[model samples]
Target: MAIPNEALRKVLMEIEQKSIQSSQQIQLVKAQIAAKKRESRILQLTASEVGVLPSGTAVYEGVGKMFIQTPPSDVMLRLEKEGSDLKNDVTNLEKKLHYLETTYTNSRNSFEQILTRAGGSV
Candidate 1:
């Protein structure tokens, strides 16, 4: 099937927006992970003050109880893999966004020139 340049341009714009959004999401994930790390540190330090969190309970001092997660040895490995994947995706998306911006800029410039030739055709 054939596609018009305008349609293709719109599609590219959409792709660029999505990539920018994905990059933002990646940043958010990194922030949340940092927050989780801080929370974990707090839990470890306050564990004694909060007193053993009692495996069966969910709340103490207006906060949820903390339970240890016993994941398979590969959990960290998988998380590292996912982090690597996300970083790569963010990088690729940034590159694509740059290309899309350049393409859109060039296309608009070309169209503006065309209009100029037509004497205020725009």
Candidate 2:
């Protein structure tokens, strides 16, 4: 069946809009991954430094809006757990970004094929 010109135009516009949205989402995910990696590195460095601190040294850790005194070992354990969680979040975001890219590519390709069949430029 032949698609009317108006219908084809609407379909193409919707596809373009979705593709743009996906691109933006991918960029946001990339930024999140970068931020997470940076945080993880900072935590690793802090943990290493804390490992060499003298026993019974005072350590203050920030919790939300307040700083609480905590043991160096406890701080190290918290940092390690947070780092692991961030790494896992980054991995999951990467996978989601990959899936979005694939879907966007397929949609764009289909749109292009339809436009070409209709003698359109895009």
Candidate 3:
């Protein structure tokens, strides 16, 4: 038996809401990935600039509002580790964004199909 139009319309509305939520989540993840990419680039540039310094040169790293003298090698190592962590974060966020996008597409398709089956347009 064919489902009632009212029921189908309700389901369609719910799916539409879900699709919108998924789209928002995808946007948030994309923003996070972009921010991480920028941070990683900054770290890389800082490391490159540090590479040109003499071995005896003092390096200072900012901690909160204070800057403490740090070894150049230590600074380089820390920057490398931070960059790696940021890269990993971006990768994970990308995967999450992909999942959200797929979910959103599926929800949208289902919403369209339901609307069509109900002989309606929104």
Candidate 4:
């Protein structure tokens, strides 16, 4: 059985649209990774200077729209943990984005081949 040109065209269009959406998602994920990396760098820097601050030094932590006084030691530990979590999240997102891109490319190529066989321009 042979597929119709119209059906092939529709499938190709759908695949192209999905590819575009996947590309957009990848860009968003990349931006998130960049932001997370910046945050992680700042945290690492702060953690490195943990011994410099005086015991009585004042530190404020942001909680929503309010800032609460917090211990520097507590802040240092929290920052290190949060940075590690963000790094892990970025890694997982990168893997997912890679998979999406690979699948999108394969689907687009297959659709293009079908369209070509149907005497249609991709």
The lDDT per prediction is 0.52, 0.89, 0.89, 0.81
Ranking by TM-score: 3, 2, 4, 1
Clashes of each: 0, 0, 0, 0
Superposition TM-score, candidate 1 onto the true structure: 0.41
Q: What is the TM-score of each candidate against the true structure?
A: 0.41, 0.87, 0.93, 0.78
Model 2: ten consecutive residues of lowest lDDT: 113-122
Query: After superposing candidate 2, which stretches have Cα over 4 Å from the reference?
Result: 64-66
Two-way lDDT contest, 1 vs 2, winner: 2
In model 1, the runs with Cα more than 4 Å from the true position are 1-73
Compute the lDDT for candidate 4: 0.81
Candidate of highest TM-score: 3
How would you encode candidate 3's per-residue C-alpha lDDT over 35-106 as one tens digit per residue?
999999899899999999999999998899999999899999999899889988988998899899999999
Q: Roughly what TM-score does model 4 have, to 2 decimal places? A: 0.78
Residue 26 Cα positional deviation in candidate 2, in Å, after optimal superposition: 1.0
lDDT of 3: 0.89
